[model samples]
Target: MKRTLVVGVDGSPESRAAADWAAREAVRRDLPLRVVHAWLWQPLAYPLAQNRDAEARLAEDILKETEGDLSHRYPGLTLTAEVLAELPVPALLRAAEDAEMLALGTRGHGALAGFLLGSYGQQVIAAAKCPVVSVRSAHGRPVALPEQGEVVVGQQGGVADSSEVLRFAFEAAAAADAPLRAVRAWNSPPVYGYSLGPMWSADQFGGLEPYEKAALEQALEPWRLKYPEVEVVEHVEQGGGGHVLLTAASDARLLVVGRRVRESSVGVRVGSVAHAVLHHSVCPVAVVPHP
Candidate 1:
């Protein structure tokens, strides 16, 4: 149960990109990197012995290739590779339980089409105990963290709900020596044609901006003090949370968002804003689970 940074690889271009990103992050965090590939044995149509052996060999090859590439790039990094003989979703979930963070590559269809995450990726992100980062490869290769770009994080709710997200964002920014942009979005109260009582004033809607701005600043105060080296940019906007965060992260090196752990009869759920950012953000997206 050693804590390490884990990256899942599937021999796809996107997974290669994720492995590269995870290696860099591991170096930054001073943690070992574990490369994992899950191979689900499918019954062959003819049930040939060679087919099964070939499949197993391919899985090992994928791990070795990824390990060699990453080791070449990060010679000082401690790394290991393993192939799990299980379904991907459960294998990844188990791998993430003891990991500091888990990184997975998301397939990007096109610039405007956004990322396409399979059901397994969604399930893993929803249930992982540690933060899950969805990385998209740019130009069929790994996208480097921008030197001047900030680490943008969507901040909402109170300190209790947002503290984990902020902590991750600040630590990422501090590691990269980049600025941290904290964004909060608010919607004006809906106007009612008829006022029920004098307690309801039309001026209340216009005055919400200041209150929201103050709340965002207050929530960020402790984090700012804790990571004094991280330059913070506070953004308060009136719009949809997802859209606001996406716009702020247009030039970000990393975008951090929070997913509240909610239990349902069916399964765990990722919040709407986090879902949207995961699909559309151009930068690497980190979904941190919080209470």
Candidate 2:
């Protein structure tokens, strides 16, 4: 099947907001949009077929309504809706395999009290093959990023194979005609004091600041050249990765981060930094899967 921007939707306002966000992104990328709703029917003691029919109808209604609204708002946008009789996470993951990106909605930032990520949304973010954007629902409406805001990207501060994430961030900024804020963090190793070497004074460690700044600049140089129109802002600071990114993304239209795809003995492994931003960012968070 042709690639499209896929959105996972339910009847909730959060999911509706996700669908709306997907529509806008699809328009930006000039791609088709697909809305997917997954449903399951619990077995009843009698008339199991009736229960299944009711569940299917409800799922269909959700898809149809979302499709209609999006099509009306965005005329001539290629659209398709599907109702999958499978588990939410697995179905969304399957849909994501062929999608340019998968977007879903959440209640709010997890750092706030009484805010928790739905199990299915968390599972899809951890395992989806493509980039996944998580948006929050508030005021019973779709949360839209400010049109004039910049796109913030978190990096590891050196020139490495973080090209996929960087490219996505740059392209997004270029598309929106907004600045790209590249944020990198630096910190002393956790074992600094316990190391064999003698303790170093603050003055002795002050020289590292320039090195970190140079690394961030070098890492962003080529991308800057490639997208000359995009204004680049580099922020190199000494702090925890997650906190640095969270603060940088506070005024961003979208926060982009990389996720290295790895198969561990336990299961899929997501970096702590990406996991934290996914849960806490106020704006939409895009987790780009990298090899």
The runs of at least 3 residues in candidate 1 whose Cα sits more than 4 Å from the true structure, single-residue gaps closed, are 44-50, 108-117, 137-147, 192-206
Q: How many backbone clashes can be found in candidate 1?
A: 0
Candidate 1 lDDT tens digits, 49-75: 646677788788989999999999899
Cα-based lDDT at residue 122, candidate 1: 83
Q: How high a TM-score does candidate 2 get?
A: 0.85
Give the alpha carbon lDDT tens digit for every residue of 14-33 in model 2: 77777887898888878899
- Give the clashing pairs for model 1: none
Leading candidate by TM-score: 1
TM-score against native, each model: 0.88, 0.85
Worst 10 residues of 1 by lDDT: 108-117
Native-referenced Cα lDDT, model 2: 0.80
Q: Rate the local accuracy (lDDT) of all candidates.
A: 0.84, 0.80
